[model samples]
Target chain A: MMRRREARLGWLFISPAFFHLVVFALFPMGYALYLSFFKWHLIKDVRQYVGSSNYAFCLTDETFLHSLWNSAKYSLLSVPFGMALGLAVAILVNQKLRGISIFRTIYYIPAISSGVAIAMLWIYVYLPETGLLNSMALGLLGEHGRLTPMVASMLGKPDWHLASIDFLNSTQWAMIALAFMSGWGGLGPKMVLFLAGLLGIPQSLYEAAELDGAGRWRSFVSVTLPMLAPTTFFVLVTSTIGALQVFTPVYMMTKGGPDESTNVVGYQIYQEAWVTFHTGLAAAESFVLLALIAVVSLAQFRMMKSTLVGYATT
Target chain B: MRRKTWDKVRGALWATGLYALLIALAAFLLAPFVWMVLISVHPWNTPIPAISDLIPRGPDGQVHLDWSNYGLVLFDPNLPVARFLFNSAFVTLTVVVGQTLVSSLAAYGFAKLHFRGRELVFALFLGSMMFAGPVTQIPVYLLLRSLGWLDSYWALVVPGLSSAFSVFLLRQFFMQIPAELDEAARIDGAGDFRIYARVVMPLSKAALATAAAFTFFGVWTDFFNPLIYTNSVEMRTLEVGLSIYKNSYGGSNWPAQMTAAVIVMLPLLVVFLFVQRYFVKGIMLGSIK
Candidate 1:
């Protein structure tokens, strides 16, 4: 009787969250999948079923292709660089140094700074004149600043014949910027994870390596790298997802702009849904993105031999 | 003995190298905030020097340091950033409370209780977190629109509450709680909710704190949803409020916007440091840690 009462109470306790998920999350997802099979604008809508046509359009659309490529670019830049930077920092802070936690804390701050603010700050830093980058160029280069010519381009004068590297002007650099920023912002979580992995590494492996005449780099390779595979694998998968889903900064900062140069699939879906009012196309795009993420993650799992958490035998 | 000496030297070198690497990382991480503060304190939207150095040089000829911008953000009633703060705090606090209670209860059910289809339900919950947040915007908004909740707190607070990730984290931590506690609580004739409220909750405070802090920070710092959903100037959150400064001052209008950014970040900074002690308990939902 007591067990029965507890079970009843448990369901009662859990019902609110279940209700929320079912109402807001599960229902919307089902609706979205249903909506993807047809067309409906959320604003003033009629529903029309088009079967596989939405998927077909997404598959063939050059714009979709561009968005996917941009997303891939961002992910590529973010993952390897982000992981490398994270590993380097974690290795640094893992040592027995006083006040190192301050560095750890400071480095971790960016992870909380969010996308819009970081992009805003970067915009200031990259400002062509009187901004950090140009100002430095002016000071260092003296009178004939290398970036002075590009100033003309902004003025629409002589096309600022030189020193023109518009980071957001083209698709490639836009992706690079997104990737780099994502990496920069994401460095914190990965570093912390790597730090934990570093701590988990048994001291015996280090001692064995030291006795075998291995130096710092050699130990890092032979012991640290091998042991850290799990952490690296985890970081890579998450970062890959994060990079692929890049939206906030691109929307806030660039709006996929200077000519849709930086539009990643995530941003494209947002635009298609919200801006263009093409819910069906957006839903189809979302499914495609989900499929891509799933495939990539599964492939990674297969490739990396990542360990399951509680599985002692793995 | 000679090898020991070499090891000592190696250790010192490694220490030096570590410090060097850390210094560079610190500079990169701290540079933006430092620059933001500098720009905030100054008056001109002019160029800061090219070096990533934190010092503000008053754009060649200007001499007087302009702190008027900072004051304007605080005192200007027209800007109404203070109202934005109140709105943000209210919504954030509500969501934190609601999410904590709901997610923790759900977590308790999934973690401690024996329920049918628990594993399947748990999987569904986890999968929702991966469902692109933006994907549901239209459909969800349409529901809110029908309910006429576009500008209301429910749209902000309800949709923002109790995510799969939070549930997963709390459940993971709760499962790790010794089963003896629950069994003992049951033996003492405590009801499930009573056991949860008394024993489970107090024990799970670390996990609760982690979830609370993350949720608070997320709601407080979130820009997109608020920007899109809330139309009224009065309904705006701090993140959206700051964007007003962005539009007015123009992105190029430095010093002023950075001041606004600083103001936006100040509360978060304080709350972050205060809550940070509880925040670091996150070991990820998986046990790879």
Candidate 2:
């Protein structure tokens, strides 16, 4: 009787969350999958049974394919750079210095601010000529600054000009600019995660390395990197997933413009569903995105396992 | 004595270098915000000021800041900035409170109550976290539309009422509270509901605050959901409203745009300043688990 009462109470208490799961999560998953098999017009309320055609079209769609590629490019640009910068700041701020929390709080400002606001602000930051970045560069590095010539030579384009480089308006630099902005805005959370990982590292390991005459650099290379493997893996997977779904920045700043160079998968999906009213096609695209995330995450897990083994062997 | 003096000099130099790097990085991170605040105060209907001219000045070379842009953005006749702010604040608060309550109750059941398939149910919740916004957005929108919840508060509040992450975080915290406390309450003629309310809820304030802080920020800054769910200007939240404002009225009016952005950003910054401890603690807890 007591067991029966407890079980009943348990079900009662969990009922709300269960309701959410059934209505929002489970139902949506099955419905989206079902919707993927139909060519449904959201506005016209028209439906046709089109088995696997939506998926086939998505796979062959040039713009959709390009959007996926753009997501991969963004992940490539942002994730590693963001992680490195985050890890560096995390190490710097992990000290027990005076007023350290102040720095931590300031750094974290970008992470909490509204994405649209940040994107709007960055629009000015990347504006040509009178904008913050260009103006600052011009002020510090004169009109005929060697930066233009230097970058031109490095890229093997003698006429390539860094001056008046309208970052968001230029096809070549738009995605890169977005990547840098995301890196800046996302640095705080990654730093906090890495700091937590750093705090978890046992001090005795460092001491042991030091006792064996390992210098600061050596100890960092051996003890610190090895110990931070799990955290690094976690940050990597999460950051990659986040980079793939990046929409607000593209929507606010670029709208997948400057020759559709910045058309990320998220924006593509949005355009398909809402803008073009291709609801079924959008559902299929989202499933493809889900598949991409699963494959990427699984690949990361395998790569991390191999790296751990390599570290152990070394 | 000379060796000791040299070591002291080196240590002083190291400390100075560390501080200099930290200060420089902080300045870089904060530069955009500083610029936004400065530009928001520039006079209305003026050309986009140079970085140096952002701070207003008179003919006499005295500092004279103009807050007219802020007033214009806030009290514009055509724009419903006030309405958007109300929608954002109300929706965010409702979601925070509702999410916390439902998640905590479920967390209590998962943590303390004995039942068959408890672990299975909790595992399902954990697994569901992986299939967030992108996958479910279309179907959920269809569901909300069918319910005639479009352009309504029901659309915003209901979808955000329960989150898997909140449930997970609260469960982790609730499990740490002593079961002996519950047993003691039970022996004293209190039931599970009373024990949960009187015992677990008070003990879990910090955890609850952390979850609420996350919810508040997420709901407040959310752009996509409000954009799709609400089509009319009257129902639009601050994020979507601000974006429309920028595109519609912000052609060359940089100051007005900046002012609007600042208005949207200010409340979150102020709240963050006070409850930042919970933010840091919550993040650490999330990662540690």
Question: Candidate 1's interface RMSD, please?
Answer: 2.1
Ten residues in sequence with the least summed lDDT for candidate 1 chain A: A305-314
Work out the TM-score per prediction: 0.89, 0.96
Model 2: DockQ vs. true structure? 0.76
Tens digits of per-residue lDDT for model 2, A20-90: 98899989988999999999989998999899999999999999999999999999999999999999999
lDDT of 2 by residue, B1-289 (tens): 9999999999888888888989999999999999988888877766678867878787798998888888888788887989999999999999999999999999999999999999899888976786555789989999999999999999989999999989998988898898899989999999989988999999999999999999999999999999999998899999998898679875588888888889889999999997888877788777654
Q: Model 1: clashing residue pairs?
A: A130-B47, A130-B48, A131-B47, A132-B50, A135-B50, A136-B50, B39-B255
The candidate that achieves the highest DockQ relative to the unseen native structure: 2
True contacts kept of each: 0.44, 0.70
lDDT of 1 by residue, B1-289 (tens): 9999999999999788777877887887787788788777665565454454345445585455577887778766787878888999999999999999889989999888876667888788877776546457667877888899998888889887777778888988998999998889889998777888999999987889888888888898887788768889889988887777767767667776787778777877788777665544574444343
**Local accuracy by lDDT, each model:** 0.78, 0.90
- Best lDDT goes to which candidate? 2
lDDT of 1 by residue, A1-314 (tens): 85776678667767888888888888887777887898777567877899989999999999999989878877877789999988987887887899977777787788777455677787776555555554665654435666655566577775443343446655456567667777778877888889889998999989999999999899988789878888888888877877788777887667887677788898898888878888898888888888898899889887776343423354
